[model samples]
Target chain A: MITTRATTRGAAAAVLGSAIALAAGTASAQQPAQSVKLGVVSFLTGPAAGPFGIPARNAAEILIEGLNTGKVPAPYNKVGFGGAKIESKIVDEAGSTAQQVTEYRNLVQRDGVDAIVGYISSGNCLAVTPVAEELKTITVLFDCGTPRIFEEAPRKYVFRATPHATMDSVGAARYIVEKKKNITAYSGINQNYAWGQDSWRDFVLAMKTLAPKATVDKELFPKLFAGEYGAEVSALLTSKSQVIHTSFWNGDLESFIFQSSARGLPQRIPIIMTAGETAVARLGPKMPDGTIIGARGSHGAFFSPDNELNRWFRQAYVDRFGVQPTYPSYHMAQSILGLKAAWEKAAAAKNDARPSVDEVIAAFEGLEFQAPSTTIKMALGKGHQGIGDISYGTYKYNKQKGQPEIVDVVRYPAECVNPPADMTSTAWLEGGMKGAKCK
Target chain B: MTNRSTLIGALAFLVLAAAAPALPPWLISLATIAFAHALVVLGLVIMWRAGLVSFGQALYYAVGAYCVALVSRFTGITDAFVLIVLGGLAAGLLAVLVGFLLARYREIFFAMLSLAMSMILYGVLVKTEALGSTDGFNVAPATFLGYAPEGAMLNLALFWLVLVLSALAAAAIGVYFRSVAGAIAVPVRDNEIRIEFLGLSVNRLIHLKLVIAGILGGVGGALAAMTISHVDPNMAYWTTSGGFVFVTILAGAGSIAAAFVGSFAFEMLRSIAVALLPGAWQLILGSVLLITILFVPDGLGSLFMRKTRGKEGEPA
Candidate 1:
């Protein structure tokens, strides 16, 4: 089952005739002309900029630069049906659900964008979905993990380049089932949003399947981006569970760790933070050491013989931005490259012309592409959502990056965990997931 | 009252109402918000007439907005008719509760303490994302009875909706002034003991006035939420409560219709100023507020009133 599931998001990119948004007077007049403007929504400033905004900036700058510099591959420069070159204009989607909607409108109506990119927060992605559908443009998300996005709309013009990290809940539960067979009870303190809710749900279901003996002690929903957890931390500390799981991130998670460590939450239950990898690099020492940590992408971190692509990317990013990119930046690099791969693949498949968005999406269905992170494979499922490699990592200090990276990360190939698209919760539960210890 | 003042008030309201439907989407939104805020301020003008400034106005406003949100989210009763009633009823109940505590206080204590009441609701909303946290709830598209509102027609319908509600609220206050209760409620501000000795319950009158004020404020909030289809925690913030107070002070206690005019002026000025200056519009508003409060303490509403009253109104 694991082997079969790993290959579900089998193809990363490339389809028949996809068209990217194009800018005015950029590349509208050529062989096969197709024109459109893409609205790029990302946090250009604010707390999320370090993780989210910069990566988006890098993707837009690099991709557009690639196109403008004549470095773009064949078909892309050749023009398409509408005589439009892919033009992406960026807008600041900083703060709140309401602000995102405003920026989305400005991009769609004011800037005249036909496609969209971005959404660091799963909640933001949810907010933008209705508008995207109303505008009838392909919205490709780079770094959001709420599984509900896929469930709510399957064939809609939305695509997710990154697979869910919450699948690690299964990986974590699987490890616990095999490693610590006896520890059973658990409690969850999560941000009150879809991502937090699902992270806990998956872990709970997975643990419940592995060992029926496990018990859930308490569930607390602190406000997302709370940046403070005094009350929730106190509640969790008193709950008395053998295990604790949280998926707090950015300043919110960091602030929680700072407060929790002071209250000695680490002294009691083993804390399993799904987004712990994102925290360690910035707050390694501050993070309560030995807290059960798993990077959703990689269980633990490890660096192998430097791949040429990885090295090139690292150098290029540092050369341009003066800093090595993080997971967000790396994920963005992969997402943009994905479009490129689709353009190349579509051209080769057809008369070698600029591709349409439908063609790109078609190319993306069951496609695989290599990235600095891993060989990404995509399974176009419900809502055009795809699943691929979900890696896991534990905290370890890396001096050069000057933070703790997920050490000894395990790359979970698209098998064993992720089910087929039509597999219902009940069907998946009945198969190898019964008697699981969720806590 | 001079015919010119009445004529100007009527003309201003009509022009605003008419231009509202023709304006661009952004300007319409801005003017609509201003009008809603102005409606609430009109109720505050009644309280201010009694020399009592209540800052706890957001209590009713949020109650109304949330009532609409709660009913809309929890049930299928999303018609504008039902939502307006729910907003008014919810705000009325909260007013009944807050008015009890507010009855005893006057002057700065009443204003300060009233602000506290609105702040309590804000705290709860900021902490609860299920209620949309600080981001607030997305007002799903609303219907007006069996007729669905959309496009410029929707804006026109909403404008008429505001006009009808504003007129009803203003007319209710007008009728209240002619009654024994409204007269006595004003005396509670000048001499509470004197009014009590006159064999009327002064606190009771204050409570009724507060409830009326709350309903007006709530109706304003509900209308706002319907027009925007988005509500946030800031709607309940003390700053919002303060904005209503500022508007009422600017409008004075000249007439209920003054609320509509004051709000229209504030909104139009704000929109044009904002479009021209962008971020510095707040500076322009602050200056206008400062100058108005300093030079025209009676409020922008008193512009409709003559320089002095002809009749020696009873002090008690």
Candidate 2:
């Protein structure tokens, strides 16, 4: 009986000891999380996929991988966001606004994402903004160009890492007035939507302020994704405008170039496309050499800054994708970098501990960070909207290299192109661009 | 039998409402949207019973949504019930206007004309900058009887509103199915000439159905607008209409409960497909649709009816 009791006591002690050790192991494992889950949304299968969404997605993939593996250069070379690896859930954004809202809710509630970085379509951005705020999710909008997102309402959780369309139009107008001395007449052909309407309006308003002598000839508003531009081209040709401005992008931009070039519209009139940089690589020589292009900011084949970040990002992107990174890719990189900068700043403030969402958001507000293209300033929309220098250049096709290149790049300061923090883009333009601190 | 089924549906709705608080916010939102869209499918089912398929139901849907948006933007009336009623009236009025011409057509002609009308609305909305054009605009948060709620409470309130509205609509539609007008639908589908010979204007009957469908669609759109907190031109696009039609086909026209069940199932399947195959969700959805058509031609609703009939030992 004594021997049996001793054996039972030893067995119970063994079981109790193992249980204690297992509990200790679980506690250690739960103390420090190795990764943070990010919900990355972009159009994966749709018309927007090839030019804008896919490039953005590609950049996100590379950037996330780089950040996780500590392959990124310098300040952004941190091991992910504040030392936690970023595990991304890439979702497709090729659906209706309602559908996107539903998907976004799923990403936050079901997928349990820490932060959201995506949305290429302005409509989708607008739709998801309120939801993001309601959910208190840290959302960084990469490439939606609508100015109304910030101007319409103030937000705490939502931040745009790229400049809105106002910058592109204002910069294009400045480039046009400076380069083309004798501007007799100008016309615009923008899609009949908010982005198009806003772009055209800003461009026209900027022209009114800069070149008051320029006369408006013919303004045509085509439906979005209207691939056939025969009538539009005919109208442009007949109008004989010295300059033609268009904000067409993706399939519409490509289709317009093909159709307009076939009719020799570019040979007769010098065209200014604010969003032309997106199509340069694909169009190659098909895009007329003298055509003016704006990269929204200092992005794409245009004059992005020659810095270490740019050098590393451009080379890595080219190596991975067999093509140079476009403006969308740059935008995506900047958004991720912005998020990383905020996360690190918050963590540093908290003594190298994992910061909460509120802490990160507080750190992100009005935070200026370096991007491959330009220095991104959270200068507008109550420190939720980003501002960056925009550049315009003339498109050139190199025969020897067999590639499309931008030449004669003219960069505009962010303050010169974007509205002041206190004013809306429309109000600023209508007020003759008061308080514009152009250098 | 009808009373028994109605009682069962009421009991089911009560159970769902009581259980809603225990559900996650995402599931609640998803259910709200599903129930809202089910109203549109219910309208489709109404028309389907009479051998009519209005491919442009999104016309009413958009009209209803835009009405709520415009009213909220301009009038500053955040009352959910009022906005929904106004939305239904606007869409119902539009239906009355379009029904005059639409009631004369049948089959593909009816479908194409409806599509053309919705496209016209889409083009107009896309051009009208005041309404935010193709980018659309956001709708203000809704209130119930002057009681303002925010955040999760707001979501819960909206879900409850949608549930109650859906249940009421289902019950009312159930009653309509037994009435002389609703009972004449299958007869009209089988022999329009016979119905006309029986001293009834078939065109007028179809017009009534159209108006009823229009109101239902509008109510659905308004609820959806409130839930989504935004509206765009895509709401009026043919693809939106196609989705409603797809749900209708999936639900079948056998019973009213089928609309809600089918819509919920469709939404759940879509969410699952999206989660599992983000890059190829459309492919998965297409496959499911193909499978359903090949195997369950009468729709998922028929299965429920068959099961109920087996248990009750009565014809469904």
Candidate 3:
């Protein structure tokens, strides 16, 4: 009984017991009954909600549920923000930018939320940034796609958890050039707004660099929320462009797909959609097979399937919402996880006292974490912007699964698609892949 | 009795302004926007009383907003008074030019024509990159008489400015209502031929009304831009025009106070609807409108006027 093995085993057990007890004591001591209040802004009840916004809101709800209960898997485990429970106030992001601005102020000043998360529209994103700074509230922009947010303005208290739309455009163009051949001509039909115009511009610029031989033709800019594409489809058909692209999302995308599919436009030309993943569930059987699609990043159906985290997230999402997680879901998950990690880091640094806004923001700088879809790196835009690799694939309707699945997937690293930290997107693209790394 | 009513209106204005400091920022901001929108409704009320609804009042609203934005951006002008006046003038000039063609139409044709004119501006705004396209852009912070204010002070200053301007507009409109041209607008609505037979140029009178309404709409829009510090083509969209029309219908074109009351009530109800039932605000608004149309017909204004008539034994 007193042999060397027995003695060493006893000593190890004692050390483990003491360590566990100490950790428990520290956790209990650090976390009071107080909770972290978060204002969750999203298109909860609007036309945008069904496809582009509701999934994200659902993911936020489920993810926060898990976090508050300490059921989230490793790395996101432990109670919310160093053992404090998370309480969220959900606000619907309907109406105009002005309405959003007022709601944002209300959420901060009236609601007294510690932080605010969510904004699907780029216009709303641009509108809230300065106000966020003025109030010095920790704000995380979950899914606004304007690059102008970081560039052309100085930011201190604001951060974007999703890559700008430029990455999506550049990534889509690269996918086309690399995967498809015989793309003789390029054309586009985008919403007539900043997001649409910027997407079209970036795609064109990238295509010129990647596929210079592809002649440009048949460009159309339909008004946002136009709800009809018969005329636009007719123009595209008449032009007969070999390759077609669109940045339509949510209801607009569904309407376009519905209208264009009836006219058999997809079969005639190789159609690529920058934000096609949004409509996958709604247009499942209706969407034709082999339609090239992208999810803005390694999100939606075009994600890393090998990771256990991805598997868990996708399964949980489908089980809860009864639909496959779209890019919006992935984005929402990434933001919450990223925010939890940052808060934990700050809490640990402060010996488990509640972290100040500055402390949290400082902790957020250059933060990196493994997300459900991909590894998100706060690598660009002064560490206020998250960058992740882009994923693209062709839609193939799986009869057995009764859903549209992505096939022939292509992946591009964040560095390849997103501009470097020191350069703006337009400047970086203009420089012709000067420092980009692609494989 | 008229003087007493005016005094009561003044008292209400002072009380609201004084309570602003105690009220929450959200309410104050909401009030500012509601009052600004009230200006648009005031103009709509004028046209509505004449039975000439301009479905594209957003054209002038957007023009006013853009004028404020452009003047500030290009000239570095931050004075609220100067920018607002410039906004009114810019929209007024455009209205004067377009009114010639718009005044020539009536009924559905008039509404459609106005909508078309507004859409043209929307199209132009969407295509123009310098105006930030559909995303639009923000206006600089407004300063009051060379005194810069921030946060609560800024809110207070804007509130006072809006209040003073609104009261002045209401008073002036009240006077105009008592004038011959204003008095004949309703008659023109009843029978244009009769008004013409009375030696009044029906077209000329309508042209004047259009200009007046356009100027009011422009001023409202300019004030809106300052209060919100933003502008977009949505301001000129048909839906925006529809909103003004909706407020006009809900408030009725019975009195000037109705415009303010209706707009304020709409904003308050919207805020409450957004809070209690975020997705079903439109449904609630529709229900209210349906009830109003079925029961009152003349709107909330008619209700107040009814009460006054009941007490006084005649229409106030």
lDDT scores of the candidates, listed in order: 0.65, 0.89, 0.83
| Candidate 2, B1-316: lDDT as tens digits | 6787888898999999999988778878988999999999999999999998888999999999999999999999989999999999999999999999999999999999999999999999988887778789999999999999998889999999999999989988888889999999999999999999999999999999999999999999999999999999999999999999989987888889889988987787777667768888999778757756765667777765666677877743
Q: Write the per-residue lDDT of candidate 1 for residues B185-205, one digit (tens) a residue.
A: 567777889988989887788
Between candidates 1 and 3, which one is better according to TM-score? 3
The pairs that clash in candidate 3 are none
Query: What residue pairs are clashing in model 2?
Result: none
lDDT of 1 by residue, A141-227 (tens): 778765555654454567776766446677766655654578767788887655676677778877777778989889888766778
Q: Candidate 3 has what TM-score?
A: 0.92
The top-ranked prediction according to DockQ is: 2
Ranking by TM-score: 2, 3, 1
Query: In model 1, how many backbone clashes occur?
Result: 84
Cα deviation at B183, candidate 1, in Å, is 8.3
lDDT string for model 3 (B1-72, tens) is: 567768878898889978889876766777788898899899888888889888999998889888998999
Docking quality (DockQ) for each candidate: 0.07, 0.32, 0.17
| i-RMSD per candidate, Å | 17.3, 12.3, 18.1
Please report how far candidate 3 places residue B272 from its true position, in Å.
0.8
Report residue A298 deviation for candidate 3 (angstroms): 0.6
